[model samples]
Target: MRCPYCGSQDSQVKDSRPAEDGGAIRRRRVCPDCGGRFTTFERVQLRELTVTKKSGKRVPFDRDKLARSVETALRKRPVEAERVERLINGIVRRLEQSGEAEIPSEEIGSMVMEALKGLDDVAYVRFASVYRDFREARDFETVIGELSRPARSAPDDGA
Candidate 1:
């Protein structure tokens, strides 16, 4: 790795460890030329994912874009950055586990909605408003009503 302090091509790794979330490798390096130290992080890219939009356009799946959407909904909310990161990771992992090279944009929106719903109800409604393209206040009311309902359990069946 090139040293940022002196632009030296020669560097030695002083220490290496897994990052906080275990999603990346953190390396502490020293530049021989400048006698400077720096840190680097490495992450693995399993595969490229494509997102199929409603207009029939296919684009590479962008984690930043997904984060921005979620963050926008979470703006002014009490959700923490770590929680958001975890939520994004969970969503991406689910998409990857589906074993599909291409995924519909609607599916991505639904996944975000589900994640937000569990994290924060206000954020969930905010995301649903934009994602579902709410045309009137009634749309919000409908979703709120649905969320307020108690989950129904299946009837017991004797074996």
Candidate 2:
């Protein structure tokens, strides 16, 4: 690694250790020329994800924006912010696991709808109405129909 202080290419690692979470490595390096010491961190580089819109426009993935949409949908609801974050994380993870760098915007919306469905009915409908671009009253009914489905199974281990 090049020395950040002296810009010297000749450097050696003084020490290396794993970070607390074990997701990254921290390295202390010293420049041979200037004896300058510095620290560096190394972490996995996530692959860039792209979203293809209906208008044929491709955009970089934005997780904060997606989380904000979920927050809006869950407004005044009993769901917690951490739950929303977890929902966003789960969606991103699922997309990445698909091994596709580019995903359609509609697919993302559908994923959001499915996630919100498991979260809360009202929030799911709110997000669906906006994401599905509900044109009229019948659009509302369609989502409401999906929301009002009967619960088929017992709750998971979590309360």
Task: Give one digit per residue, the lDDT tens place, for model 2 in 1-159.
Answer: 888898988899989998625646999999999988999877553678899999999999887788888899999999987677678777877887788999999999989988889999999989988988889999999878766665445654656
**Location of the lowest summed lDDT over 10 successive residues in candidate 1:** 150-159
TM-score of each: 0.74, 0.66
Regions of model 1 farther than 4 Å from truth:
1-17, 25-42, 151-159
- lDDT, each prediction: 0.90, 0.84
lDDT of 1 by residue, 51-74 (tens): 999999999999889999999999
Give model 1 RMSD, 1 decimal: 6.0
* Top model number, TM-score: 1
Could you tell me the lDDT of residue 145 within candidate 2?
Answer: 76
